[model samples]
Target: MANIQFRLQSSTKEKKPISVRFKVGRKTDVTANTGFSINEKDWTETNLPKKNNDVNKLLHKSLLKLQSFLEDRYNEALTDSTVIDKFWLSNQINECFERVEKKDTGILANHIQFIIDNANTRKVSGRNQIGISKSRVKGYETFKKIIEDYQKTAIKKQIHFLDINKTFVDKFTNWLINTRNYSKNYSGKQLDNLKTVCLDAEKLEIKTNPYIKQIEGFAESNEERFIVTLSFDELEQIRTCNKITNDAHLNARKWILIGCEIGQRASDLLNITKEDIRYKGGRMYLDVIQRKTKKSVTIGIINPYVVDIMKNEFPYKVSTQKLNEHIKKVCEIAEINEKVEGKKLNPEAKKNKPETMRKIQNFYPKWELITTHSFRRSFASNYYKKIPTAVLIQITGHSKESLFLNYINQREDKDANADLFMQFYERLNKDKEPGMTVIRNAQ
Candidate 1:
């Protein structure tokens, strides 16, 4: 067993430094600085601060945490039969306070590499069998590449942890937006990943810039961009278009129609197989587990067009990148060329050339805006008015009604509200007796 207590050092009439005294067995005793100070009158014999203010509250919390950490270290050392001397106790205290020094102390790039390696191979704590997803590993790799590029092009030198001050953060953000041409949301995500890495490094006793906590990342405002979704007429036009002759284009069109009807993500939509479609009680249904959410959904196959596709061969194994490209080409050929406002990367813009970066509000042809994801948006938007919101959320896997509504871009229209009010009124009056009608006079 080890005994630990907080004590005050000898001083004059002013404040004195506080220290922790540790005693293990009868032969070993040591004292380590708590790195805190207070007036002699402000501390009580119970080894707790007596002041009732914010500063005292913070000191109290730090002391409790330090005590807990030291006790844990002491218990672990006991099991290993480690030396219980003053030097060992001092080293433990230094580790708790993150006072260790190393030759590679604050290399930002090295810390990022550590994070990437850990994310790639590490499992969630307490879940020994499950490792992190490959997508997350790729995300960390992407952020590492961005940092390396910035270091080479902008700074021309390696960045240290201490170099990540507010000025550096601001410059990096500007470079991401103006030079890299990244959207505000995506830039924010990258900055957030960097922040996460910094935090993990700090936990591992690595010194870092204090100003990292003071920085704020960019966020997207609702007014900055519009949520684009295809209307019912546009989807109908794509379905009835006769200009498509190429087999690849025809396959892309069929997949788009299936996606709009099923409302699953492209990752899950493109992987559907004939075995996933089942016949139950003489009705066809799609049984699928969403790849992203892992939530199983059973969709009734009622659309004749979708049934016809299923009767033949469905879900042609198309790569997501190729699907996006082919879908845009199919939409363009169908003459779905209405002008719609959205965001798109400028083809001619070169990174590191700020002059070529365009503002986000440039309108483009809707066919050019169509991607693999547009089908899901089209399905959610077109069917929301016809089905109950809760039922639709079950199919779309939306956890909240507001989020589902926003995803479909379905704001409350005045005509729709009036129709709902009339339906409610009719329902309420239908149960009334025959002579219960009231007459009103017009002014």
Candidate 2:
């Protein structure tokens, strides 16, 4: 439901400017002038043009049409969760009236929408669609909300692309970090999105700040990387758990074991089907063309439990989100609750409010940190060195061994390397006297 009204704020004998007030869900109530005027005496009690004359009746019909148009537009905005304010409302009025003076392409919100509108069909390399990912679209919307909140609370005005400069960024960053209590990584993402839209505007031949190119994004330090993986023993605990009776939990447990043995990303692993499994030379293999990197990989299913589950009842497809949730519950039931370093939901944060609970870093129960990503990291750690690094890299779809090694917590086997060197020396000295230069003996 929408509540949009066009009325004069003060009654007078002379014609008064009609103001448009738009409100939805008690969250927004903004006013803007409609650029239509009428004397207060000419209006009916219902705020329509008086029906006493033909001109007034025609004016009433035209106003009704405009009202219907605005209502339809508001419905579309509500469905898309578009950020709305006095400026946005005013723009709608201006657009309906066909006035271009107040319409500025420099506005950040307008430019973002311009990009989004075109993104639906934007193709990359004539094959894949760009900016069509739900995560990316939702991310841009969230970024807009952050900036809107910033302006509302701190600046009390709309910001434009040309307004983006060193000074504006300084205040924006400070307000995001100190005032809003947002993390550097999250705030940096918002800034990065702003830079992206500004660049997009430039490509459209729209004017933008000259310093937009100088704006840089940031990330967390490499040393502070948060890694969460289940060990072999902990994974075994989950495997042996018998308390899970819920079908959803059972389905998630199967995915956890299969994902760990296969060493694939959530997107690729969750897309697994019975048809993807193949039998080659008496060995079971699951084939996948990696979605993110578009790499072809065939992973051997060696774990007996995984092989059994795949053979018996292939997991009914579960969403990535549902799998993450159910797996945590399964692990908790198996008593994998050791306190470890990870991020968890903030206890004090308000529910249903994304801005309230940013992130809290502290030691949480092991099960609390478990996610779909944990299965991949767990596979790498649990079988490191037991399996050839090159083979594992292929299974994981990593481009290089170095990149694969950095993803897991396992250390290099220096002892095994020494043993190999000793064996080499013994073979070289076979059936011959070893030559050694003897120095002074230590006393």
Estimated TM-score for each candidate: 0.64, 0.66
Query: C-alpha displacement of 152 in model 2, angstroms?
Result: 3.0
Please list the residue runs of candidate 1 whose C-alpha ends up more than 4 Å from where it truly belongs after superposition: 1-106, 124-129, 202-206, 209-216, 349-360, 410-443
What TM-score does structure 1 among the candidates reach? 0.64
User: Where does the lowest 10-residue lDDT sum fall in candidate 2?
Assistant: 122-131
Candidate with the greatest TM-score versus the true structure: 2
Clashing pairs in 1: none
189-252 in candidate 1: lDDT tens per residue? 8888778777777888887778777666666766675666667787779889999888999999
lDDT of 1: 0.78
Kindly report which residue stretches of model 2 are placed more than 4 angstroms away from their true locations once superposed.
Answer: 1-103, 125-131, 348-350, 385-391, 398-406, 409-443
In terms of lDDT, model 2 sits at 0.78
In model 2, the Cα lDDT at residue 436 comes to: 89
